[model samples]
Target: MTIFEATGAAGEQNIWGIVLPFVLMFAVFYFLLIRPQQKKSKQRTAMLNQIKKGDKITTIGGLHGTVVELTDDTVVIRVNDTTKMTFERSAVNTIVSSAPAVAADK
Candidate 1:
């Protein structure tokens, strides 16, 4: 083949070699990091949505209490009989024990 044709073929291969690594890296990142993070975030959102009065929970900052009231963006926790504290809904970390399910009258 002519020198010009040879160089053109090598140039095409060179472009693919550079681009293939980037494409593969993006795929790896998506599977290993992005996907799991998104899944965990959804689970956390679901857990937060399920919060209700009387459920025991802990906050991200380590406070533990029973849920007393809930609002769109806040929760009032009863720390003790005479002590209650309000926290942002997003501050909740985990539900310690789910509240008992209410039964319907037969």
Candidate 2:
């Protein structure tokens, strides 16, 4: 009788054995994957809202140019003094400085 009762108590205590692993996995995923992704998305949104004419930016396709115009959903980027291309606002990957890079002496 004592042995049987002890086995039943063990089963009850181990009820959480199945659930605890899943809960720990979810917490790990949230911290390692989901939380940083959400933070990056928020920063991207803020950058998009701050876009303005003449800002140098890089696109997701790796094109770098200066912003010439902005619309509700599109931007006109000047690739050169005489050439410009339009892209969706979401295509911008990052902003770059318009200042010319200092050349290194050979």
Q: For residues 5-103, could you state the per-residue lDDT of candidate 1 as single tens digits? A: 999999999999999999999999999999999999999999999999999999999999999999989999999899999999999999999899988
Which residues of candidate 1, in runs, are more than 4 Å off? 1-4
Each prediction's TM-score against the native? 0.90, 0.79
lDDT, candidate 2, 4-66, per-residue tens: 999998898798887899999999999999999999999999998888887899999999999
- What are the per-model numbers of colliding residue pairs? 0, 0
Clashing pairs in 1: none
Candidate 2: Cα lDDT at 73: 97
